[model samples]
Target: MGTWGTSIKDNDAFADVYSEFFDFYNKGGQPEIISKKIIEDNWEILEIEEEKNSLWFALALAQWETKSLDPKIISKVEEIILSGVDLKIWLSLGASEQDIKKRKIALDKFLEKIKSDRPKAKPRKRKKLKTPIFATGDCLVFKLSNGNYGGAVVLATDNNPETAYNLVVTTRLNQSNKPTIKDFQNTEVLICNFGQWQDKADVTWYMPDLFYKDYADIYEKIGKISVDLEYDNKNHDGKGYLFKPSWTACWGMNNAADKQFESELTKPKPKKTLTIKQLTKKEKWWKVF
Candidate 1:
């Protein structure tokens, strides 16, 4: 819907549909199956008549490149183009006469490209899987800002070296002395609720970056749990994973591997709290509450 240019890839829907098609294709999905799934998954895109053009154009281009162009898809695009419905929609969206002319030219070129036969199909690429540094049941410990230590358990891994991350639960053992392997297994995890630390609502993070064996100066592997995972699974003891874990993730790391734990150890995230004096700017406002 957000159209900044006249090119097929200029629109948001086109880029999304095109990328998804290739993603499934690279994963060894059959072209017909991938096309159907893409249509089903993004059925909403087809609802808006204006947006429908982007999806069909993207799908057509992808299919053409893969040498699997479908007649029905080509026919749909052709109908939209020749009928001039796309240009009318553009005019409705307040496009200039010049821009509409350019879009029509682009559409004609696109139709010609897809209607032609490709000499060869583009090769399907293999998707690289991410692998985790620590195992599912591994116990980990990291230093906190107050010279105390924080505990964590590696609940699961998505087997990706970079992307698929480690699923971990931080423990509540904020301690000054170093804890042994036994301590990690016995302690309760930090649970957040109503923005404060407490009950049923908790946080489980997907961390692509983590402290590895080399970063033992600040973080280290203590041991493993899970007679079969989940640190809270009642199958292990009595308290299973009853809490609904809130999930979050971080993005755009330059080098997640070498710098994950090292950066945290050197400069950890600071926790700043405002005391009454700081809040009152050191004034005698204790009676103002």
Candidate 2:
């Protein structure tokens, strides 16, 4: 309720949402329940039209101020982040998914930017986007520690009590150094926020050429590599924005249209047609078709 206090002036709807948020913040609101209410019930009443996900940021800031960065709150905030780009300015200023203290500092800068850059009237265009969070089934463009870029697909996610969430990913290990769209197979990886087992994960791989022959050897050489990557604007260039190694990067959920393309990419490609020589090798080749 710091800067939000100023904006609530003459806006009863904003005040109502603010009031309800603090009530839940202090009285222990069910994260999932309250989140559903915000999306379904209070969406219009919140009076945050220009920035759709601003209320989540408001609540996130409130939680930060109140020293309540629990998994419940974090998970709910993450849902809002996945839905849209309302928090672009904040994330672009380096607001992170790690420590509350660091995020508080980043949020301070974000609020200041909002105050200073508050337009007297609405602008024609929206702000530019920052790095996006990769959701399940979405294609990933990753830059390795060796300065090489690789393509991957987020297979699925699971809730782990120890780690915030686990990501099962299919990767093209030993693929081209340059980033390109290719069928990923032969390797699977799991990503998590943090834990004893998860913390030891070496995201970077030992090239499976000469040095590494088996999974054990590759696992042995697993170095602590940064997982947060910038949104690859469909460019496949190796350029990507970097985040603090400690902060868990946020991701944007793919919309239906985006999901369609991803599904196509994940589907098995048709096999090549048999050559004339191979066809002639079999006496009953014509029946094979």
Candidate 3:
């Protein structure tokens, strides 16, 4: 005799419910009806033999009852699994014993493949900063030797610092007509005019009447001008203020000048006003009290 025959067991309501559910499903009845019947009968048998196949049947029934029920079940199952549980225990409660075994095997294979095929994430590379371009002959107004604002004229071409320095030296000698470099150094002439090198010449230079217009035109032909200030402060010990000519400032000044000039050109005239009077007739009646 088998052990099953020797042992005594109580047949519960779940047995009847399961049979009814299976019968309804086999008969192609609505799954929702079957699920409700099973729930009403209090069938708690989540794990049984052939659980996976049984679950498929149950889920199919659930869908027949309500299309979204099966998907809801799947979501719940995933959430429960991710929440943490012993794999063995989780498997035990599945539709059946065989399903539990198969799922465990599949899970192990998936984990092993993930471990073998995964690539290590590499660190991201930092981007390099771009050097800015500056133009030549830009006038830079700065404090000079005698507490007076002096403009440094840019004389170098657009090139590296060393090349610009050489150009400045050559241009200075040519301008002074001095053959000796020492004679050129004694004059308050600054080399490369670093202070003014980056500053852009005011657009007023293009206008007809500016005093420096001719000099500005000559400077433009020389090279790209820029202020000599350190462009990139990455190596600087601390932050420092740098002066640069702003187009906004220049535009504002130009607007102000334009307004002043317009005011002088056209004075405000007094507004003339005219007045007129009209007469109308009316009748009044008095009542005696």
lDDT by residue (27-105, candidate 1, tens digit) is: 7888899999999998998997668888899899999999999999999999989999988887775555776888888
Q: lDDT of model 2 at residue 269?
A: 23
What digit string (tens of lDDT, one per residue) describes model 2 on residues 1-289?
1011112111123333444554454455654455556557755634544333455555454444444434555565555444434344334423234323443444455444333423242222232222212243445554432344444443323222222232323233433454333233223232222211121111221111111121122111112222233232222232331111111111211111122222235443222222211211234658878
Query: Please, what is the TM-score per model?
Result: 0.46, 0.26, 0.21
- lDDT of all predictions, in order shown? 0.60, 0.33, 0.28
Instruction: For candidate 2, report its TM-score.
Output: 0.26
How far does residue 127 in candidate 3 sit from its true spot (Å)?
73
Give the candidate number with the greatest TM-score.
Answer: 1
Candidate 3 lDDT over 249-282, as tens digits, reads 0111121222222232354321221110000011
- Candidate 2 achieves a global lDDT of 0.33
Better of 1 and 2 by lDDT: 1
TM-score of 3: 0.21
Sorted on TM-score, highest at the top, how do the candidates line up?
Answer: 1, 2, 3
> Against the hidden true structure, what lDDT does model 1 obtain?
0.60
